[model samples]
Target chain A: MADSFSLMQEQYAKILQTYLQEKNEIGLYHAQQFSKKVLENQISPEEVVSLHLDAIEKFFPDLPQGARDSFEFLLEVMMGYGMAYREHQSLRDKQKELETEINVAANMQQTFLPKEIPSVDSLDVGVISVPASKMSGDYYHFVKDENNCIGVAIADIIGKGVPAALCMSMIKYAMDSLPEQRLQPGALLENLNRVVEQNVASNMFITMMYGSYDPRVHHFYYSGAGHEPGFYYNYKTDSFEELYAKGLVLGITRDTTFREYHKKVEPGDFIVLLSDGVTECRTDEGFIEREELTRFIHQYKHLPAQEIVNNVFYQLEKLQGFQLRDDFSLIILRRKV
Target chain B: MSVQSNVEVRTEWGIVSARQAGRNLAKEIGFSSVDQARITTAISELARNIYLYAEKGEIIIEAVEEIHSTGVKHGIKITAKDKGPGIKNIRQVMEDGFTTSGGLGAGLPGVKRLMDEFDIDSVAGEGTEITTIKWNS
Candidate 1:
């Protein structure tokens, strides 16, 4: 095999030399070798072409810029394919890790969310929460203290991922550690804002909607922390009014003041506090028109809390070619005198 | 309503952004009393610990059978596990006002205080898992 390869190498070298010289006829050395391999005259044209390509690979001068560019493109294609394959593998690994982490975190976060709104003596409370992803930043909580006054809040942390989740931790701590739990909603937001600013990064923030209900008064007072304004449906007035408490988002301004807004919730009256996820929901038609959402709530003002939330989600889901880009959360509270 | 409910709590790093997620879930379920508040606090603190310290962890919440009939026997159990820089000293970490420059270490102690029962297992550089129970009354 070595001898034969050497012979072929010799032949190819001569052919290269002849090509370089621009000779029409085969060189002597090439002719002699070609004859030895095909003494019976069985040499095929394809063999000649194959031999010629090998010869060119060894001895051809550098290709022109255009030809070289094509070669580079071929290399690039190979590299691109390799990178794509690697990225797919990496994404799979990340996905598995994310899936596992999401499962864990979701569980932890879920424990904080109440299984059901406690049945206050004369108030009907129903709440629904859904995360935009495996994990989300939207949160709503209803805590009934010894006073039987329920403190309800729906908060949206700035940013997504682990950082926001951590902020929630600090917020919960401050809320839990408060020796004075019965402060006005504005004061509670004040303390929470300071705690969040002290703990969270400079870039992080949380938008929250908070309120307290005194069944005795049948009145609900609420405050907003840069979250969207909520709506109050008064059965007596047969109308809907917005709940807007002017306050800076937590972690943004410590000195910023928040005003507590109140609406007398009577029998058959309901308050709807929700994150921006619902209003910002995009549709083929457009982002959920704010007016339309308001109207939607007004239309179903008399429905039960669960039914109301379900209908909203149902509509959002049916939005053709629309997408839910954020976590949507809602809390419905009704006072039955 | 005398109904037995089950929930499992698990924690993982940067899993998602919506935190009050669990709180909302609790409201949807029937645990809306002091018991729910306790579990909710525990879950929040543990989850925050996982996010701030180890940069990652996982938790699972599931409903368990009822016991100790005082209020609602239905309760939620949380299991938080993470494989990030475990606590250097569990005792010190549990101490109030002894923050590790990573926000206040009010998490574990707070969690213990909030749960009907709280248990912790952790090793430095290994991981930590906190299991807690809250029974609705």
Candidate 2:
């Protein structure tokens, strides 16, 4: 550090001598080059001012005391700014480190999601999930039993970032361990609630919906944990109704009971499940009403289940001016008997 | 006594500056650490709203004193103004679990809860302005 300072000082002194003698652009150019070198050595502005003062004193020993004192005042002001600049640089480095770590966490969360949507003979299923940010606060899982009964679960964590990603992994493992409960949506939610209440923080809660489709009975049994209500389209009535189940969000209490509901599925009928990202989609005018969403669904209802979901998503995405504010996840199940 | 600070809300750094300014003013006004956090959190939400919705806006922080019948009260007032597309439905946005951004749906309602007084005026195309104040208790 001392060697660099002396080297810079010698160069600065030479520049000052030439600039004072000639007062030309060439001399000014050298001074600019010297300034660049000083910055490369991380020299503070106050230090540069001090070096200039020293150069002036060396050239003229009779320099006025008042003029020198004014330079000293400028040095003091630069010192405060110099300190703030250094602090700002350190903070920027820390922010970069944190962003890199979040990217890693986001990658790990992706692995926790279902690798492929499970194929069931009696059911045609379509699912789509998009995160508003790198880290998603929403998750979904699929399990297929020996009898071909497909269990589908969708959950939204009431938080964001790394913590939400971590909670999602825990939930995925917990559901994996409880294979027996998958066929029973009500029991599944009850067991998961206990797990969440025990492992998660008190302030953090999860809203979830679980459903199992039995092809033999053509019954769609489902349960909820304070999640958004899904829609049941009655082909006979050509109408839609809310699929409501009474329950509290997970992690709220040690022992919370979830009520199971069922609707017999007929050919051409379907069920729609989604996060608030779909139901509460917003545009410049206002939120997209639930009725409008139904109309959108009906328009594409004749298409394959997958096409239906994709088209609806594109429509809503466009309505929100191509920017989604929340994580969007939607699932559609149609019986193919 | 009134001391004011203005932060431009055009980028992420703007939101951070607004929060820091709010925290400093709240602390200077003799608020407890909890209240300081609340004030900063509210500032963050409001400032973020500006950046996300309007693309560019401003956050103004001021230390204010209110004269009441009982006594004089110290408080901090924050105003977030933007000329971007205004909110069309203030009532709907105020409900919990209502968010367009993939957040916790705790946008406007959360801000309202964090401060003592909240007022919002917005027109569909003209602009939007939100003012909130928290008194030191």
lDDT for every model?
0.68, 0.84
Please report the interface RMSD of model 1 to 1 decimal: 27.8
TM-score per candidate, in order?
Answer: 0.53, 0.59
Q: For candidate 1, lDDT tens digit of each residue in A138-218?
A: 777778877788889899886655666667666766777876558788888888888888888888879998899988777
lDDT per residue (tens digit) for residues A1-337 in model 2: 4347778888889889988999999998998888778767877566788788888989999999998778756764564344444444554666899899888988888898999988877788998888877888889998888788889999988776567777888899888888664448999999999999999999888999999988888999999999989899888798999987788999998888888899999987898999888887899889889999999999998888899999999999999889888888899999874
User: What stretches of model 2 exceed 4 Å from their correct place?
Assistant: A1-65, A180-182, A235-238, A321-323, B1-137
DockQ values, each candidate: 0.01, 0.01
| CAPRI tier of model 1 | incorrect
Give one digit per residue, the lDDT tens place, for model 2 in B1-137: 34899999999999999988998888889985546666777798899899989999999999888999999999999999999999999998875446665324247766776689999999999789999999998
Which 10 successive residues of model 1 chain B have the least lDDT summed?
B1-10
Best by TM-score: 2
Question: Which portions of model 1 miss their true places by more than 4 Å?
Answer: A1-87, A320-322, B1-137
Where does candidate 1 chain A have its weakest 10-residue lDDT segment?
A75-84
